[model samples]
Target: MRKITAGVFISLDGVVEAPDQWHFPYFSDEMGAAVDATLGAADTVLFGRKTYDSFAGAWPEREAAGEEDAGFAKKLGDARKIVVSTRKLEFTWRNSEQLQGDFVEAVTALKNEPGGNIALSGSISVVRQLLAAGLLDELQLLVHPIAVRKGMRLFDEGDTAVPLRLLSSETFQTGVLNLIYAPAEPAADAGYEDAKAHLPQS
Candidate 1:
């Protein structure tokens, strides 16, 4: 069973949206390398429709030729992606599929499938849903030092603190901190879900 890793590049105030604003500068190399590590370990990427659309438009251009391209964005175009969007959008990337129905059903089925870890990018809506469904296995946070006064946040209005144990923590030379967390395994519960649950038939 592959882990479901939630990867995020957030600010001091937990903003995960565009960081290229006049005041909020983009992430540095240290942050990039840490995020790249998580992307490298994943065989699949999962996102909501909004994130998929945002990424799809930019990743292809970056993959081919872009000055701001990173290692992860390049691999993103080629990795297996599952987009859970209900807005009736289309997918253009190869090995990409749209999950249109119930978010829980679609995400649960994806989790039960046989594959490597499912990495999540910037999809706060989807992340909240997944978090509520208790499907995320690991969390990789690349925390930058700057704080944006206003922007889209990663947490939902109803979201509360979920207990997590830090598996690893590292700080890079560029002042970015890498924090890897795993959900707290209950004393009696065998991990979170039954590992034997088979994937829903395609």
Candidate 2:
């Protein structure tokens, strides 16, 4: 089965929105390599509507301009992209498809298909939904040092608590924390609240 891995850039305060505002200052060769490695591992890419629109608008233009990361842009342009949307969308990006129907069911079916893995980036709502549905296999958070006090947090208020187990962690010279986690199995004797309480905070 194909694994569904989510890669997100988040602030120290858990804010995942508008990473462009604060994410670049800390970008380094190491960070670039990490991103390259993540992309290399995935054969397919999944996106929420907003992320799809943003990427389709920028990557194609970057590829056309022959930018510094033109190779990366080309890879993104060529990869099979599955955009989750309820309404019909004009997908001008190459190798892209729209997924409509029950969100969890579609994603579950995708996960069961034969593929390397499905990589998800910058799709907050989609990530939350997948986590809640127990469809996410791995979560990789690039935690920056700065905190943007006001923005959409990764785990917002009233969201259901999902337990996770830390699989690995790395600290970069730029102080970016690359934390990897997997969904934790609920203990046989533990209640939902107990299981959540034992999980680490992101």
Candidate 3:
């Protein structure tokens, strides 16, 4: 079974939306290499409707222009793209498909199929759903130093706290932190009981 991994660029304040406005200052060869490695590891790309539309608008043009990262853009263009959307939209990108069914069920089926890992990028709502459904296997956050202060955050208010175990972390020269995490297993009953005992009685 392939693992479903989400790779996102976030600010110190947890803002994940519109990283392009602030992320470039922190870009470096190391960070670029890391992005390439992550993309290289995935045979499939997943996106929500908004993200799908955004990428479809931009990456194809970049690929055509032979811009820097054009090779990576080609890789993305060639990969199997599954967009979770109910609204009808023409998919002109090669190998792109629309997924209008139950998100968890559809993604679960994809995970069970034999293939390389799946990569998810720039879909906060979809990522939240995946986390809520316990469908995400790993999360990679490229944390930048600056705080955007006002934007859509990765974890919004009223969101449940999902336990995560740190798999690894690396710091780039540009002050970008690559933090990798996996969902932590549920605590044992005894361990939970022990922690509960320390809480104040009402």
Cα lDDT, model 3, residue 122 = 74
Give the alpha carbon lDDT tens digit for every residue of 20-76 in model 1: 452225466766666677766678888877777777888887777756675556678
Q: Write the per-residue lDDT of candidate 2 for residues 93-118, one digit (tens) a residue.
A: 99999986899888888988887878
Clashing pairs in 3: none
lDDT of each: 0.75, 0.88, 0.88
TM-score of each: 0.79, 0.89, 0.89
- Number of the candidate with higher lDDT, 1 or 3: 3
Could you tell me which 10 consecutive residues in candidate 1 have the lowest summed lDDT?
A: 19-28
The alpha-carbon deviation from the true structure for residue 44 of candidate 1, after best TM-score superposition, in angstroms, is: 1.4
Candidate 2 Cα errors over 4 Å, as ranges: 186-202
Q: Of models 1 and 2, which has the larger lDDT?
A: 2
